[model samples]
Target: MECVGVRFAHSPKIYDYRFGSQAPPVGSWVVVKTPRGLELAKVRTEPRLGQAVGEIVRVATPADLDQHSKLKNRAEEVYWWLKARLRREGVRAKLLGCEFTLDGNHISVQYSAEQRIDLRRWVSELNRLAGARVEFVALGPRDQTAYLGTLGACGMESCCSNWLQDFTQVSIKMARDQQLPLSPEKISGPCGRLLCCLQYEHQQYQELLAELPRKNSKACSLQGVCGKVAKLNPLAGTVDLVTEEGSTVTVHKSELRWE
Candidate 1:
């Protein structure tokens, strides 16, 4: 099956959609039929063989673009109104943003909160007030950060907001294995969670660590001087040994024999 990648506004994840006979150029806008209804999405990749979640209705026309623009403005209005309403209702949720389907018949409002909220009563009220079906989406800390993107500590756009499609488990042990500082500010992302990049090179680091002697274990140099493995330089494939004479010497892993 021929499919192309499409992405909706305010989201980084790309979804595959069957284009059928219509070939939309990359970076062009197209209307796609989603479970929620019609949505305006940007073509992100050339057509390829893949399973599609839905089908593209058609390439967006100028009128469709105009309607999409108006829908964005309307969504913004709904966002502010909902924000104020939530405040008045004393809802303990942080509003991330709002999005409207291309047809303007549905609106999705995203929020983040420490606990789940019961908005069953507000759904009907919002539907009547906004003249569209209202959906409230709860986001985790990572999803909230992905929705409202910011520069990472590396001074580049965040991977979660750029191209990361799914969240993976990141552990403190990964940072420790890579010899990174365990400080929260250093190892944390804007999401207040462990940095996703920590796992990128973790396997390579682990492989390197496996080939080196464990820190604080005893090892002998090629010259027959035995010492405790004080520190490891996984990147350099070297280990620092603190000898019985209290002298520290750095040697390649191949030059040392594990004791």
Candidate 2:
């Protein structure tokens, strides 16, 4: 009933495999039979009884790792080769990354494009060169971010690469709720979509926003203005108010009362 959580090579997503007859240690590299093919994946967490997406094939030996590396070494070559062919064949797509199974029986590609591409010829050429089944998977904004990981604007490894297993729909409202810069470069991650991290404190922001009075609502302030609440800072517990004389003043939340 136990299962092993496994991640394949720098991917943030993890899949569970039936422990079956093997109990690999955390961080151990093990061969697993994923739906894609035989892949060598790392044991990502402590084993537990859980549903599994696939089953462990065996503990990956040094030989297995060496072969896996050899196949991976061909990634750049395969990438360039496909890029050239796609161009020659007038296939319009941006190739993001390529993955090879541990057994070198299959190669999966991630790409993006504005329109659907006819890939039968492309796949055949790849299958002939790599001697494996070729899979071309379309990637979304989040998938593009994961395939080619990058440092985020926060100056750290992006969350998607480090630990994000799945992406949630991000909205402009989340950015507005957090008072983030509305600029595209500032609000969007390396993925060119709203940063996935924005949702981390979204619920809290929504709760806090609800607790505070809205703009232009009448509120009592220590400044003795009593005109209207202009802005609210939930984290700082401060509010900005406009006075009857049209002067704006800031006051702590403790000094304000809303009807």
Candidate 3:
């Protein structure tokens, strides 16, 4: 027996459509066994020989596609229902995404909230109301962006939904490199994700720091000694000096009356 593989449309699970000779036709919907349960899925990649182990029952007709389209198109309505339902239940959840399988047998609802919510009862209510499989998926701030998506501050498409694959941890160091204020609002995005551009030019600023002086090497004429290099404006060519006399003096970088 020859095996064929098909990738899922929106999931990580891959299905192998079995055939004696050829691959399954494209745009066909089929049922496959997922770890959780049987899922009605679409065949993104038609099965090819020597593929991974999975079952792809058969190709679906145009009828299945039409039904699936209806279900998929109802995503907004379903999302609204879920939001209202959750609010009523005092769950405080935001509906981030809704997806329906090609067979219209499954509905996946993704959401994000500040705290954990026991939504089993709500899920049951949804299933009873919609007459379809209801799945409530919890998501993080970043995952919400990946699912629902929104425009970024740059007035362009969001990175999470468009191109970015992984979210790297950002820190205050990155903000310091770019000489940005340490305020949280300026550095955060709508999704609370760090500004994507923070990582850029960081190394350049770090290298620029290397040519800078060590603190306490210079002195302020007004005050006896400066504590340390509290702040520096390279562009302004000004260094804030804290003197030993316990006073602060703004001195020009080029004005070295130090000697």
Alpha-carbon shift of residue 182 in model 3 (angstroms): 1.3
Question: By lDDT, who's the top model here?
Answer: 1
Q: Tell me the TM-score of each prediction against the true structure.
A: 0.94, 0.92, 0.62
Residue 97, model 2: lDDT of: 77
- Per-candidate Cα lDDT values, in order, are 0.91, 0.84, 0.65
Per-residue lDDT, model 1, residue 110, is: 92
Model 2, 113-222: lDDT tens per residue?
Answer: 87877666667778888888898889877777787789998999899988898888889999888877799999988878889899999999888888777877988866
Ranking according to TM-score, highest score first: 1, 2, 3
Off by over 4 Å in 2: none
Residue lDDT tens for model 3, 45-112: 54456555556555655765676568766866777887887678777777777877555567787777
Better of 2 and 3 by TM-score: 2
Q: Which stretches of candidate 1 lie over 4 Å from their true place?
A: none
Cα lDDT tens digits, model 1, 111-208, are 99998887667787788767899988999989988999888999999999999998999999999999888999999999999999999999999999
Candidate achieving higher TM-score, 1 or 3: 1
Q: After superposition, how far is residue 61 of candidate 3 from its true place, in Å?
A: 8.5
Separately for all candidates shown, the number of backbone clashes (residues 3 or more apart, or on different chains) is 0, 0, 3
Of candidate 1, the 10-residue stretch with the lowest lDDT total is: 118-127
TM-score of predicted structure 3: 0.62
- Checking candidate 2 for backbone clashes, the offending pairs are none
Candidate 2 local distance difference test against the native: 0.84
